[model samples]
Target chain A: MSTRGQLLLLWTTPVAGVLFLAAYLMFPGFSPPMSPTMTPEEVAAFLQANLTATRGVVIFVNLIGASLVPFFACIAVQMLRVGNSSPVFAYSYIICVGIGLTAFILADYCWGVAAYRPDRDPQLVSLLNDMAWFFFIAPAGLVVVQNLCLAGSIYLDARPKPVFPRWVAHFNVATAVLMIPGAFAILHKAGPLAWDGSLSFSLRLATFAVYVAVMFFVLLRVVQQPVESEGVLL
Target chain B: MAITTADAEPLPDTNGNTTAPGLVPGEASMWFFILGDLLIFGVYFVCYMVYRGEHAGLFLQSQRHLDQGIGMSNTVVLLTSSLFVALGTEAARAGKAARATRLVGIAFACGAVFPILKLVEWLPKLGAGITPGENLFFMFYYLMTGLHLVHVLLGLVILGFVLRSLRSASTPNMKFIETGGIYWHMVDLLWLLLFALFYLIR
Candidate 1:
């Protein structure tokens, strides 16, 4: 692909990130997240009270899966240049992103369904809400794998001029480590490890936001350099 | 590029005597990882303190349940392991490959005791039905220490690689060795803070 084309794809990262963040603020129960300890009636009541905003989020949520594709494509393009051998890391990264995107879409769909008929049985509404949150927060393994694959590729890049800097690899590893606490969300219904808690939700969200911005700048720098050497094609 | 034993060069001395002054010990990237890891953990520490202040009685009572004897023993074990790793790094820099390998081997043995002790400390409490869901204190204890255990496990893997490098390569990769050592030390440092926060803060 042309460098201009790649640059355009790379630009999608920030565009999607900012748009998502802006859309996120438009909703109430989502940004702060509903408490996991809420009773079924409270959960149903929450959706009914904020039906319009919850419904509005579904539109952005549907677009999220597709909007981030170009950004992930850009990441794979960079990964393809790292190792001399077959581009397994880039392949694995693409696969992980695919699964990760599905997870996010699934979570949103659960929310969409929950918001669809808030007048329904409270228990059922709560069930969908719980599933949505679990899907949203607990599938952090996918992101962790993506980061590890990218970091591994960067570390194995023995080129005199590596694709990404070494510190980026370390940063990726750090991000992965931070994401691990999300796994604990399932084990806690309250406190900092719950789905709505500080460690699980706030920390993961912030880390991902920072990670995207950092990678966007790094990709911008890479795309600026003329594509001269051949390593692997995406 | 594949490195052969014959082509391996002597390792660089990390000791101040041979190296220039004001040099950081390991790959700059590894130091970045160390600092970033510590910053992430620092967030948890601050949050823990806040929660403790809010629920001082609960936290203090939970703190008593922790086995201080085992905690103290693990501390000594890790400290001793770290000392050997330091000496091993120095030996490797001095090009004493066999001696360096032996010292690191001892360090690995000491590091191995940590997880065993952890299991010993955890199983009884767990069997008694004390889990993360018991309370906020237990949740932080399990989550933070569990995260630290993962770090410890990864450190052992890195140490294993360092041992392989020292044994197999004629000229070891000093940067790799130093990086591993730095990570091991960070793990040690984290445990000290955890010990203070969870076991002795009352």
Candidate 2:
């Protein structure tokens, strides 16, 4: 692929994140997540009312979010170019990002299924809603692992001048560690640990979005450099 | 490229002793991880305090279930381990390779006691039907401590690598040793906060 094509592919990483956020906004996900305390009937009513919007937005979410595969693949390719070390870190990053992106797409499908037949049993609808939210947030640790892989690769780069700066590697590792607390969302219903709570959902999403943006710019700069001078400057 | 050569070469002191100067011990990247890790923990701590304030009664009641004795002893163990690690890092810096290895080995042994004591404290409480599911306080306690336990386990692995590097290399990789030391100290610092929040807090 041409260098421009490759850089465009990498840009998909942040674009996908933004698309997901837009989809979330369309579906009112920014409000406190659907509480477990809601009765089946209440959940069913909510789904029935938002059926069209939820289905349309999730379909778009699934399509755009799949772009993450190519995005992360580009990252793996760049990582390989910067170092002669084992390809393990780069490969693991691609694998984890692949799995994480798949989970995200599947989560949208789960939501789609919930909105498909609102006339169905309310309890089943509630169950599917629960499934969608849990599946969306729980696998966050995989993304964490993916970040760690990238960070490790950057840190181990033997080039006299590494493609990514040392601080970026540190940022990636820190972001990975920050993502862990979100897993506790499964254990709570109303508190900050809840799926919609500030720590689990808000802060996590904010950090992830910021991370994607930062990395997108960093990688963009790296790609813009001449092929021969790739690692010569940050 | 300029910085790389400078980093690779040790500087000579006036006394003719050569050492890397003004270099943050460990991989510079590790300090980033350490600072960010602490910030993450800080957020959790703030959340804990907010919840504790909101549900002071339940938090206090749950705090009673924690065994202060075990918690205190674990604190001592981790602090002592951290001391040994600090001493070991100094030894490595001084080029006493064998001594650094032995001191870090001792640190590793001390760190190994932590999980055992954690299990001792947890098993009885778990057997008594107290779990993260019991209430909010227990949930926070388990989640935070569980995450710290993961860090401790990882620290042990890092320490193993540090020991291996010390033993295998004629001159130990100061960066690797310092990185491990910083990580272990972060682990120690985290436990101290956890001890205060979970065990001694009102």
Candidate 3:
């Protein structure tokens, strides 16, 4: 791809972020997240009240959020450029993140399914909602591995000029570490570790948005550089 | 201090300081890490305080369950290790490679005790069924401390590399040593706040 074309692909990273935020804003009643402590009746009523809107917004989330896959794939390719002859780190990052994003898309669809039929049993709707949120936020390790692979590759680049700056590697490592708390969401009902709690869901989401923004800029700089004979830009 | 060759030697220019050029130790990238890490931890700390304020009673009750003895001892261990790391960085800058190696080795040894002490602190809690799932306070305790533990482990790895670079290279890689030193110090500084917040604060 031409530099301009590659740069445009990177812009999809932030577009995904914006779309997720939009989806979040579309939540019914702006309900303070469906805590596990919330009763099934409450969840069922929520679904019944906003069934159509929920389905539509979730579909948007699934389609638009999936943009992250292509964005990260672009990152993996950039990593490959600077990763010397061995593509282990870059490819591992790509595969793990690919699976993780796929999980997210699947989880969003589960929410859509829950909203599809307002006549379903309240308990079943609640179950589906729980499953969707849990699946969306609970797989912290997938993110950790993806970030670790990217960070490790940057640290190991050994090029005269690294593909990404060393600080970017440290940032990824820190961000990866920050994400571990999200896994604990499974253990709580209403507290900060709950599936939709601040530390687990909100903080992780915020950090991820910030990370995507930073990497977009960093990758922009990389792609704009002249491509070398072997396709390494830096 | 007496004027010696060590004092007269020009410091390695790492941070772009001209007057006392090379005074700022470590790769500039490390500063970025330090600042960003501090900001991230700051956010976590703020969240912790807010939650603790919301459930003051639960937090206080859970705070009593924490073993202050182990917490204090761990603080001491890390502080002492950080001391050694700082001294090692100075020694490396002064061109005392052997001394720097020895000090960092000590730092690594002290740093190594942290995870073991954490296990010592954690096993009994787990045995007593006080896992992170116990309550919000314990959850923060484990989550915050657990994250710090990961940093400690990574710092130990960096220290090992520092030791290797110090010993193997004809001249010590000052940038590598300083980077590791600053990072280890950051680990220590973070624990201080964690200790105050989780263990000592009333």
Could you give me the TM-score of model 1 versus the true structure?
0.53
Please give the CA lDDT of all the candidate structures.
0.88, 0.83, 0.84
Give one digit per residue, the lDDT tens place, for model 1 in B1-202. Answer: 1212232376886543334433877776566789999999999999999999999999999999999999999899999999999999999999999999999999999999999999999999999999999999999999999999999999999999999999999999898899899999999999999999998878
DockQ of 2: 0.02
lDDT of 2 by residue, B1-202 (tens): 1111121356654532234545666676667789999999999999999999999999999999999999999999999999999999999999999999999999999999999999999999999999999999999999999999999999999999999999999988777788899999999999999999999987
- lDDT of candidate 3 over A100-143, digit per residue (tens): 87778777877888888867898888888888877787447788
Tell me candidate 2's fraction of native contacts, as a decimal between 0 and 1.
0.00
TM-score of the second chain for every model: 0.89, 0.89, 0.88
Regions more than 4 Å wrong, model 1:
A228-231, B1-202
Predicted complexes: DockQ each: 0.01, 0.02, 0.01
Clashing residue pairs, backbone N/CA/C < 3 A, model 2: B26-B179
Docking class of 2: incorrect
Runs in model 2 deviating more than 4 A are A13-18, A228-234, B1-202
Task: For candidate 1, write residues A1-234 as lDDT tens digits.
Answer: 347777878887877987889767976676678899999999999899899998888877687656878887888877877854667899999999888888888888998999999999999999998888878874587889999999999999988988888998999999999999987898999999998899898998888888888888988987766654443354
Q: What are the models' TM-scores?
A: 0.53, 0.51, 0.51
What ranking emerges by DockQ with the best candidate at the front? Answer: 2, 1, 3
TM-scores of chain A in all candidate models? 0.95, 0.90, 0.92
